[model samples]
Target: MRENTAEESARLQSAAKDHLWLHFTQHGTYNDDVDIPMIVRGEGINLFDDRGKKYIDGLGGLFTSQVGHGRTELGQAAAEQAAKLEFMPLWSYAHPAAVQLAERIAGYAPGDLNRVFFTNSGSESVETAWKLAKKYFKLTGKPGKHKVISRSTAYHGTTHGALSITGIAGLKQDFEPLVPSTIQVSNTNAYRAKELTAGAIDVTDEQSLERFGLWAADQIALAIENAGPDTVAAVYLEPVQNAGGCFPPPPGYFQRVREICDQYDVLLVSDEVICAFGRLGEMFGATHFDYQPDIITTAKGITSGYSPLGAVIATDRIMEPFLTPGAMFGHGYTFGGHPVSAAVALKNLDIFEEENLLEHVRSNAQTFRSTLEKLLDLPIVGDVRGEGYFYGIELVKDRATKESFTAEESKTLLHGFISNKLFEEGLYCRADDRGDPVIQLSPPLIAGPADFAEIEQILRNVLSQASAKL
Candidate 1:
C-alpha cells in the first residue's frame, strides 16, 4: 500500500480536529491525547493507522467490513459505474445497477421479501422498515397499528425513527420526543438466565434446548401482551442483539416470535444491520437462524463499506399498498439507491461467492466458538457467546454466581482499562459498556481457525491484564 506523506497526514489530521465532527464520540478527549487516528489503508483483516502501525481489525470496522478492505475489485467497480452514470435517483427515474442489485438481494432474501427499497445506511433501512410497516397497516385498514417493538439493549441507529426503535435508555435520554410509538421487550441473554430461571439452564439429559427455547421465546409474547396486539405494527429484531453484547437467539426462539407476530397481526422486521451479508455464514442472518421475516432491513456488508448502501427488503404484501396504481409511499433519498453503491454491492456479492466466504465462516464457526469458550478458564469471562463470524465475550465479577460489575466498575474497567489496553496492544474490537463490559469480535468472514485463535490470544492477554487491575 502507498504511504501517506507527512505533509498529507498532518493536513488531514488538522482538518479532522478543526472541522470534521466525529459521530457517536466525545470531542474534547481528542484535543490533548495522542494524535487523531487516521486509518490510511486496510487489507484482508488488518488496518493501518496513519502512522503505519498495523492492528488486527477485530470488530470488522464497526461490524461492517465483512469482505475486508482494500479490495481492488470493489474500487474498480465503483469507478467504472461512476464514470458511466454517476447519479440516477431511484425516484421516478431508475438505473440498472440499483435495479440489478435489488433483484439480487430479493433473490437472496428468505421467504416472500421480494421488494427492495434502497437507502444510504443502516439507520435509513430501519427507518424505511418502520415506515413501510406503519403504512402497510394503514393501507390494510388497520391504521391503529402504529407501534413498533424491539429488544432492550439493542442499538438500531442514530436517526430519529431508528433511534426511537433502539432499546438502550442512556443513549435515548437526550433524544427524547423521538418518534412517539416504540416499545421495548426483553432480549435473550441466556448467560443472565439465572435471574429469570430458578437455577442454571438445566442442560441435562433430555430437554436442554427445549427448556432454554421456551423460556427465552416467552419474553416476546409477554411483551406483545403488555403492549396490546391491536396497536403493534411490527417487531424489529436482530438475530444476535449486538448492543447488550452478542446475544444470539435462543434455540427455537425465532419460531415462537414468528407465531406471536402472526397472532398479533404484526410484521416481523429482521433488522440485519449487523447480522446480515455473511456475518452469520449466510446472505441474511434470518437464514442462519431459520426464520422468515415479513421485512428484512440490511446494510454494512452489502458493499463491505466501500461505499454507503442500505436496503429494506419487504414482501409483496407489504409493498403492494404503496404501488397499487395511484398510491405512493412518498419516501426516498437522493443517494439512497446510488448507482455506484449498487455496482459496488454487486461486485462485493460476486467476491463473496467466488471466495466462498459464507461457507468459510460456517465451516469455521465451531472453531471460533470453541477457541473463545476456552477463555472460560479465566474467571472474568462469564460468557463467550455468538454465531458465525460474530461473537462477544461478556466480562463479569463472578462466574458461579453470575455477578455483574458495579456502575463505577463498568465505567472504570470498560471505558478505562479494557478499551485502552486492547487498542494499545494493537487489537481494534470493542470494550462496550452498553451491556456489561464485553470484548466484542466480528472479524472478516474470510477468517478461519487461525484468525480466531489470534483474536483469542489477543483477548486472553489483554483481559488477563484487565482482570488483575480490577
Candidate 2:
C-alpha cells in the first residue's frame, strides 16, 4: 500500500472530520489540531495509518478480525460470489451460500443449536434472538414469557431490542422507552466479587471462586422469580462480558446458569459477538465454557471483517414451533444473509481450519494472559483477567484499596491521556471507562508470543506514564 501524500492526508482528514460519524465517539475531540485517525491498510495483525505509521492491532479491529488482515482470499471469495449472485434476500427464499454457511455454523455450534438465522450485524442478531425467544414462547403456549434477563455492565448491542437487553445504564438512558420487560442482574466479575455479590463471597481460592460463581448464577434465578418466571422469555449473556472490559465467566458460573435456565424453562442466549470464531479458542463461546445455550448470537469474526454478516443460531427445540405447517416467525432483514457475505464467511472458516486458528489461540492463550499479567506489577494496574486471546488490564487509583478513578478522573486518565498515548506509542487498543477504567486487548488469533511482547512493552510504557501523571 502506498502512503498518503501530505495534501491527500489533510484532504482525507478534512473530509472525515466534516462527514464521518464514528460510533460511540465524541466528535468534538477532533479539532483543528487533532486529526481523525485514518487507517489506510492492515496486514498480519498490524495496521498502517495514512501516514504509513505502523501499529499493532491490539484490539483486533474492535475484536472482529480473528484471522488478522490483508488476506486476499477472503476478498476473492466475496468477489466471486458477487459476480455469481450479489444480492438475494433470505425472505421467502433461500440461497446456496446462506444455506451452506448456516450448515457450516451449525456443525460448529454445540449441542442442538442447529438452526441459523442470518443478520447484518451483531445487534441485529441479538434483536433477532430476542424476537425468536418471544415468538417461540408464544407458540409454546406461554404468551406472557417475553421478558429478558441480562447481567449488569454487559453490552449486547445498540438496537432497541438489544439495547433493552443491555445492562449499561449510561448507554440506555439516552434512548428511553426501550423494549420493556428487561431486567439486570449481577455479573461474574471475580475481581470485584465481594462488591458485585454484596459481600456474599470473596474470591481468594478455587472454593471461594466457585461459591461466587454460584452466587452470581443464582442472581439470574432470583431475577426470574422476582419478575415472575412465567413472564420471562429468555436470559441474554455474553460468555465473556465485553463492555465491562472482558469479564470471563467464573468457573461453574455458566454450568449453574444452564441449570437455572433449564429449571425455569428459560432460553439461554449466548451473545458471542466478541467471543466467537477463535476469539475464545472455540467456534462458539458456549463450547469453550462447556455449556449449551438455547440460542447463540454471533458476528464480527465470522468473516474476519472482510465482509459484514451475523447469525442467530438456535437449538432444535427453539425451532420446533415454527416448523409446523403455516407457522411463521415473521422476522428478517433485507441484507441478512447476503450471498457475498456468506461466501466470504465460508472462506474465512476454511482459513480457520486450514491454519488451525482455534488451536493457535488455545496453545498460546496462557502466554497472552501471563504477558498481560506482567502489567499487574504496576500500582495503577489492579487486575488482568480474561481468557483465550482476549484480556483486560484494570487501572486503579490505589492498588492497596482497589480504589478506581472517579468519573472526572477516569475521563481524564482514559480518554484524555491513555487512549491517545497508546495509539501514539504504536498500539491500537481500547482504553475504556464503561464500568471502571481499564485497557481491553483482543489481538488477532494469529498473534504469537512476539506480538504479546510488543503489546506488553507499549502498554508498560504508556501505563507507567499514566501512573506517574496520577
Candidate 3:
C-alpha cells in the first residue's frame, strides 16, 4: 500500500526489529504500529525512505548534518583519508589531519582557548571537558573543586561523567549513583520570568532582555553558593539549551555567567554539542552568544555526521597545568583522533569556509524566525524562541493564560498525535515531551526560506489538528 516492494520492505523490517537497538525509542511500539523509517538515501534537505517517499530533513539528522545529506565531497574525503591512512592514534604522536584540525579549532576559538583534545563524539567531548576541569582544579591545589553545575533540562551527554552533569532526571534515573558531585539549576527562559525581583532575580519588567539575563545569571551564583564555591569546579552551559526547547540565553547571560565563574574561580565550559558548527550562525555558540568560555565541548556538526569527531577546546590558562612536563592526564580514546575522522572534519571545516555556511545561516536566521513565528497566528503556539536556525515552539492550552498540558495530555497530544502526524505528513521534527510538549526544529544550515516555510506549514497543520482534538 505504501508503494514498496513487499520483499524489500520485509527485509528492512526484519533487520530493524532483530538487530537494531534504536536510541530513545520504545521498541514495543513496533509490535504492529508502523514500520521504522528506513531512510536509505538523502539529497540536500530531503530523505528518501526505502519506499522512496521523501521527507524534509527537518531535524538535520538529529542536529548533526549541517551542510545537508548526500554530500559526495564529504564521502570522498573520508574514502581518500581511509585509503591513505585508515587508522592512527593520538596517544604519543598525532596525524596530519588531527594536528591541522586542532590548530584550526584553536584559531577559531575565542580568547585564550588555544588547546584542543579530540574525541570520537560529542559525549566523549563532554567527558573530556569535565575531566579536564576537575584535573585542572586539582592540579591548581583545589582538590575540593570537583563538582559541576549545569542547567535543569539540559543534556550534556550520555556517558557516566557527562550524564552526571546532565540535568534530565529521566535519562539518569535508570543509571543512578552516577559520578557524584553534579548540580542542576534553573535555566534562562525570559518567557517564564516569574518574579524579576525575588531570590536573586531582578529582571522582572516584561520583555526586559538585560534584566532577564542578569536574573538568569544570578541563579549560577546561587548554585555556586549552595554547593559551596570550593566544591564547584566548572559551570557547563549551552549557548542555546535545546532540550528545554532551544532556550537561547537572554542578552548578556553568558557574559554574566562568565563573570560569575571567574569571580568564583570556577571554569566555564560551553557545552555546544548541538549549538556549534553553524547551527547558531557561527563556528561556535559562544561566538554567537558574545562570550568566551574557558573550555568548549563540541561535536555533532564537526564532520556534518559524516564521521565521528569531537573536540574539547581549552584556554591556555587551563592547559598550562597539563603542559607541566610529565603531568599525564591518562585519558585517551582508541578512536579519539582517528585519521579518517580528523580528515573528514578538516574537509567539513573547509566546506564550511568555502560555502560561507556561517554567513548563510546568519543571513537567513531572520527569515527562519519570521517564518516559524507565523505559527503564532495559531492558538496553540505559545512561544517561538531560539537562536539562528535552531528553534522550538512551546505549546499552551490557553494562550491568554499560558497554561501547559499535563503529563497525560502531553503523552496523548505530543507523542500520540503531533509527532506521528508531522512525520506522516513528511516532516521530521521533534515533538518533545521533556520539559514541555514543545515542537523543536533545527533544520540544516543549508536550508533557506523555502525549507522554513515547509517546516512551518507542516507544524501548523499537525499542531492545529492536534490542538483541535485536545
Top candidate when judged by lDDT against the true structure? 2
lDDT of 1 by residue, 84-117 (tens): 9999888888899998998999999998889999
- Residue 267 error for model 2, in Å? 0.3
**Cα-lDDT of candidate 2:** 0.93
CA lDDT of each prediction against the hidden true structure = 0.87, 0.93, 0.87
lDDT of candidate 2 over 1-470, digit per residue (tens): 68999999999999999898998888988899989899999999999999999999999998999999899999999999999999999988999999999999999999989999999999999999999998998999999999999999999899999999999999999999998889999988898998887787889999999988899899999999999989998999999999878898888999999999999999999999999999999998999999999999999999999999999999899899999998999998999999999999999999999999999999999999998888888999999989999888899999988899999999999988999999999999999888998899999999999999999999999999999998
lDDT of 3 by residue, 1-470 (tens): 25568798888899889999999899888865678878788889988887888899899998999999989999899999899999989889978989999999888888889999999888899999888888888888998999999988898888999999998998899999899999888887666665333534444464576777777788889999999999999999999998868888877788889899989999999998899899999999998878999999999999899888899999889888888987877798999989998888889899999999999999999999999999998889989999898999999898877788998998988888888889899998888977877888888889999888888888888888977886
Error of 3 at 209 (Å): 3.0
Question: Which 10 consecutive positions of candidate 3 have the poorest summed lDDT?
Answer: 195-204
Scored by TM-score, the top model is 2
Runs in model 3 with CA error above 4 Å? 1-4, 195-207
TM-score for each model: 0.96, 0.99, 0.96
**Candidate 1 residue pairs that clash:** none
